[model samples]
Target: MKKPLKFPDFKDEDKAADWLDKTDFSDHLEPSDLKKINLPNLKSTKRLISLRVEESLVEKAKQKAVKLHIPYQTLMRQVLHRGLEAI
Candidate 1:
């Protein structure tokens, strides 16, 4: 019988990262180590369209997005959606 795989505890994030970088985890993993997980499908219907806007507006959006910790494109989508709803 094969020995069960074990993971060593690391003192810090850097140590963990170093261990992961040097180790091939697949070599130690067994079928029993796997777990079944059911995650909701995140498929969305979004079309890619090219549109031109002022460079200043895009820069403003990017700055605001950084403050809000979201992507500029997502901020633009939310702004457009809100505008459409208001109309």
Candidate 2:
């Protein structure tokens, strides 16, 4: 079996940050640089509840996200939005 590669330890935050900044990301923008879209604000909304799901189900969703190269949270949000629209 092939062993996973290990990264070298860095002593300073600046050095680590600099290395990451130089890494190629295929022309992706930093989070702060992205254009913001105006969505309807839900600040006045209340009664939001959080639910826990089985670890296996969460892992399955994460695996699907990895396969599609998108964030798992984004996939979950889209699914929730579609379900609400159907109701």
Candidate 3:
């Protein structure tokens, strides 16, 4: 039987990447160590764009966002989503 491999300590990200690139951990890892991940659909992801709105409106949204414990941008998205649903 092949001996189980031990993970090496790296000083920084570049070393870690170098080690990862060269080493195969399949022999050392158990089935339980693997996890299934679902990546988001790139087509449906949000795109950043420039939108101009009144400063007072942004301040109101910021105040509301603080009260709801969420980022103002998130609050804006929620509001926009609701408005779109109403249309």
Candidate 4:
């Protein structure tokens, strides 16, 4: 197994930025060391269309979206995308 990356505790944002500024990410992210992670809310280069659904359903989704800290539309898209992939 590869060693986990260790980062130092910074005094503030500037110190953290300074360290990151000098560091070479290639040294850390070699192709063999790379791992895939799902990036939620990644904006797609696509046009939007008008989509209509039941208001009650939208309200319920909005309530859940608020707890997850994402817009209802983004949450819906994520759910729909996953559903599509499951087929």
- Top model number, TM-score: 1
Q: Cα RMSD to native, each candidate?
A: 14.6, 17.0, 14.2, 13.6
Off by over 4 Å in 4: 1-43
List runs of model 1 lying over 4 Å from the truth. 1-42
lDDT of 4 by residue, 1-87 (tens): 344566676655545655778787764565677667543433444458888899998999999999999999878876886699799
Model 3 Cα RMSD, Å? 14.2
lDDT of each: 0.75, 0.61, 0.75, 0.72
Count of backbone clashes, every candidate in sequence: 0, 0, 0, 0
Q: Per-residue lDDT for 1-87 in model 2, tens only?
A: 233323345555434545666665435555455455442322332245787989897888899999989999767765775699799
lDDT of 1 by residue, 1-87 (tens): 245556676655445555667887666667667766432332344679999999999999999999999999989987996699799
True-vs-predicted CA distance for residue 8, candidate 1, Å? 44
Candidates, ranked, lDDT: 3, 1, 4, 2
Better of 1 and 4 by TM-score: 1
Question: Worst 10-residue stretch by lDDT in candidate 1?
Answer: 37-46
- lDDT by residue (1-87, candidate 3, tens digit) is 345666566555445555778887777667667656443322334679899999999999999999999999989987996699799
TM of each candidate vs. truth? 0.53, 0.41, 0.51, 0.49
lDDT of 3 at 19: 77
- The superposed Cα distance between candidate 1 and the true structure at residue 86, in angstroms, equals 0.3
TM-score computed on alpha carbons, candidate 4: 0.49
